[model samples]
Target: METTPAPAAPARRRRSRAPFPVTVTQMPMATCQVCGRALAHRKGEVSAILTAHYERDHPELLGR
Candidate 1:
């Protein structure tokens, strides 16, 4: 007797933007307080970075 073949799995949809989980220990490269933009360039002025409101709601700056 011939065995029946297994059914094929459903195809997954390709995503342009994928959701991911991040750990707390991982420090961001560069943070922008105004627009909440992650950048490579460091902020020269401490006051500018600290005083500006970050859209992303950076938790690292909470205590400091």
Candidate 2:
């Protein structure tokens, strides 16, 4: 008696997980409001550098 070959195994179906949504907040770089010049700051604090630049470049605005 001839035996029939075993049926082929079913192909594996891979399950994928949905990607998670992420929220991000970015801080803008400091710039001189008068001349539009780029300013540098340390640890996200730019007031000192910005103030110095303004005082040097646009001294007239300091009184106001």
Candidate 3:
């Protein structure tokens, strides 16, 4: 008698994934209250700069 052949195996499938989420923010800059001028000082130098600016640019206000 004759024999028959065997059957073949099935193929496998691949998986897919998504990327992560992200968020961004920005801080506000400092400005002079009197004339609305911009300042370029560091963290703790605003007060001194404002005081000097007021004294030199606005000496009349010192009387008050």
TM-score of each: 0.25, 0.48, 0.46
Model 1 score (lDDT): 0.57
State each model's C-alpha RMSD to the native.
Answer: 12.4, 13.4, 17.6
Model 2 vs. true fold: TM: 0.48
Backbone clash pairs for candidate 3 read none
Q: How much lDDT does each candidate structure score?
A: 0.57, 0.79, 0.72
Query: Which 10 successive residues of model 2 have the least lDDT summed?
Result: 24-33
Residues 1-64, model 1: lDDT tens digits: 9999999999998898967987655333555645566654344654444445442365556664
lDDT of 3 by residue, 7-32 (tens): 77687766565657777554345677
Question: Cα lDDT for residue 37, model 3?
Answer: 81
Local lDDT at 60 for model 2: 86
TM-score winner between 2 and 3, please give it: 2
Shift in Å, residue 23, candidate 3: 27
Arrange candidates, best lDDT first.
Answer: 2, 3, 1
* Candidate 3 lDDT score at position 32: 70
